[model samples]
Structure formats: structure tokens, C-alpha cells
Target: MVTDTAFTWSDAKRECRNMGGVLGVPSSDEENKFIGQLADGVVWIDCNDLEEEGRWKCREVNVEVAYRNWMSGEPNDVDDEDYQQCFTFMYDDSSCPESWHYWGNSCYKITETALTWSDAINECENLGGVLAAPSSDQENEFIAQLVPDDWTWIDCNDLEVEGIWKCRDDNVEVAYRNWFYGEPNNAIEEDCAALAVATWGNK
Candidate 1:
């Protein structure tokens, strides 16, 4: 079966379980081909807890039959941050494994040039749109192309407080952030929104 809504890995697993079938974890070339034909965009699979490095558990256990298709340098597992990991079948340069620390499955739309956060939002709104929320690898790649070497503002900022940032369009929590470790301290004087320089190691 297929679904149209976006769901977190855990939630997708639960929904699949309740439906009396496992989440579609395609195991063979043929299965993956079928899955591709079955749906587009990111889809949940039955692979998590990738290496037992932690309590990596998924809804199903199919150890002998692993179905993997990661782009180059994938599953980097940098920083050893968390035991929980989910997989998206598409490749996105904006979501390079090294930078996973600061982003999530959000989409973006590029304009002809960079603009302030407010201006960017206004441009999107004027076109009957909101800030982009990329959910697929294809969308991520497209957004990456729009990014110049210089920084650009995405429609994101802290809403609840001065520094608790989120995408302006839907308040989606920023899963990944490239800000300097101690930056965005929410200094009362500089509580606006901006993006990181593509060449910089940190914001």
C-alpha cells in the first residue's frame, strides 16, 4: 500500500503495523523497482537501528535480506549522535551526511537572487506560495541549485522565543542547523533569520 501524507519514521512504522502489513522495506532489486514504480518521493522502509550500534530497532527484522541503495558516502554516521536512523531513497547534496546535523526533510524554492527572511517569505507568498518544504531528494537537489556561494535566508526563525528557530511557513522544527555551535544565542539585538554560507564550515 501507499500513503500521501508525510510521517516521521516512528509514526510511519506504527501506521504500517496497525494496517496488518509491514512498512514497505523492499529487499531485492525487483522489490525496489516495484517500490519506485509504486510511489514517488520519500517512502518509509523496514530498515532502522542500522548496525546495532545502539538500540536501533525498526518495525521489522530482516537481517539476512538487507536492501540498500545509498548514494556515495552515505550512512556516514558522523558524530555518532543518535542510535535512531531513518533512510530516504533519494540523494540530495543539501543533505550531505556531513551536514545532517542541521537539516531535515524540508523543501525550498529558489528566487532569482538572495533576500532577507521577510523578503523571501513575501516573494513566496506573493506567488501564492509559502517557503519551500522539500520532502524528496529531487526537491532537495533543486533547492541546492538555487543556493549561491553566498548565504540566503530561508523562511525560518525562532517563534516561541527569541532563538528557538523554525521554518516560518509551518513551524517545522529544524532537524538540522548549520549555525555556529554557540551562535544564535538569541541576542536581543539580532533575532532575525538567515542561512549559512555554503563554503563555511559553520554558520
Candidate 2:
């Protein structure tokens, strides 16, 4: 059954226990979809990876999830604080915390205070995220909307090795780039990447 009241994952689990039921752990795609539809937004499931970094299990059922439907780029372990260890689902997949914007199954927020590129990354990590890493034109545009009139730092950088751009989140080579002509010229040996009005450059 769906409940309208919002609660943290653990609190929701405890609430269910108080009612003589356990938190839901969908065992199939159809069941998962049904629960998502019923809840409408941000329902906590029994899945989590606290015992192991990449191994997920449903604590209520005490078994590995038989079916998984993580949104793309999910389970990224947002940061060290919360670790994003628990799972959440939304019917239309657009729910986010207050002050954050949702897009493509991820949440984003522009920092209120100006920061340098490296400092921005640290701040995001502190808040359970890396700097934004737009992998497509549409995603890029979405992030652009966050700071329309100002430049913003992103996850792209060549810090591992000069001239080799990579996404800091996973150390993977960045597959998409929007460098302006002659930009990323390593002017002053800058190794960080930033986005401006529809263009990318080194910082």
C-alpha cells in the first residue's frame, strides 16, 4: 500500500515494521513498475549496498534483488557522507531534494558560493556529488540552464595526464566534448575544464 507521508528510508522501514509489514522489495520488473506507479514519487525500497560497495541486497527479504532497474548513471555512490547506499524510485523518475533540479534520473544544484574548479569538485563531493558531467548535447543544455549567465565547473579534467580529458567520477575518458575553437589550449598549463555559454574550455 502507498502512503502519502514522506520519510527517510530507514524511518519508512521502521514505520512499516510498526504496522506489521516490511518495506517493499520488488522481485520482478512488473512488480517494481507497479510499486513505482502506486507511490508516484520517491518511495524507499529495501535495496541497499551498505554491506558491500557494489553488491546490492534487499535487507527485508535478506536476498539479492532478483530484478534491477537503476536509472542510468545511478549507484554512483554520490559521496562519502551519505554514500547513496539506499535505493529510491519515482514513477516518472523526476523527484529530487529541495534546491536540486532533476534531469535524466539524476539531481543537480548550482553552488550558492563561487569556487575555483578544484574547490568546486570538493564541495560537490562533500555534498554527495561530483561536478556535473554532461554526456550529451541535451544534458549539457540542461546543466547550462542551471547557471545560464555564468561559467560552471564540470567533471571533465586532464589532471591524470596532460592532454587526456577524463571524467573524474570514474576516471573514464570523456566521450563528449564541446570545446570552443583553440580552447583547451592548456593556456598557463590549466588542467581543469569549465563550461561557458554553450562552449567548453580549460581553466
Name the candidate that leads on lDDT. Answer: 2
TM-score of each: 0.38, 0.52
RMSD of every prediction: 15.9, 15.0
Candidate 1 versus the native: TM-score?
A: 0.38
Q: Model 1, 29-57: lDDT tens per residue?
A: 43454455445675767655555664434
What lDDT is reached at residue 122 by model 2?
84
Best by TM-score: 2
Off by over 4 Å in 2: 1-94, 169-173
What are the per-model numbers of colliding residue pairs? 8, 0
Clashing pairs in 1: 49-56, 102-176, 102-177, 103-176, 106-134, 107-132, 107-133, 107-134
Task: Please estimate how well model 2 matches the true structure, expressed as its whole-model Cα lDDT.
Answer: 0.72
lDDT of candidates 1 onward, in order: 0.52, 0.72
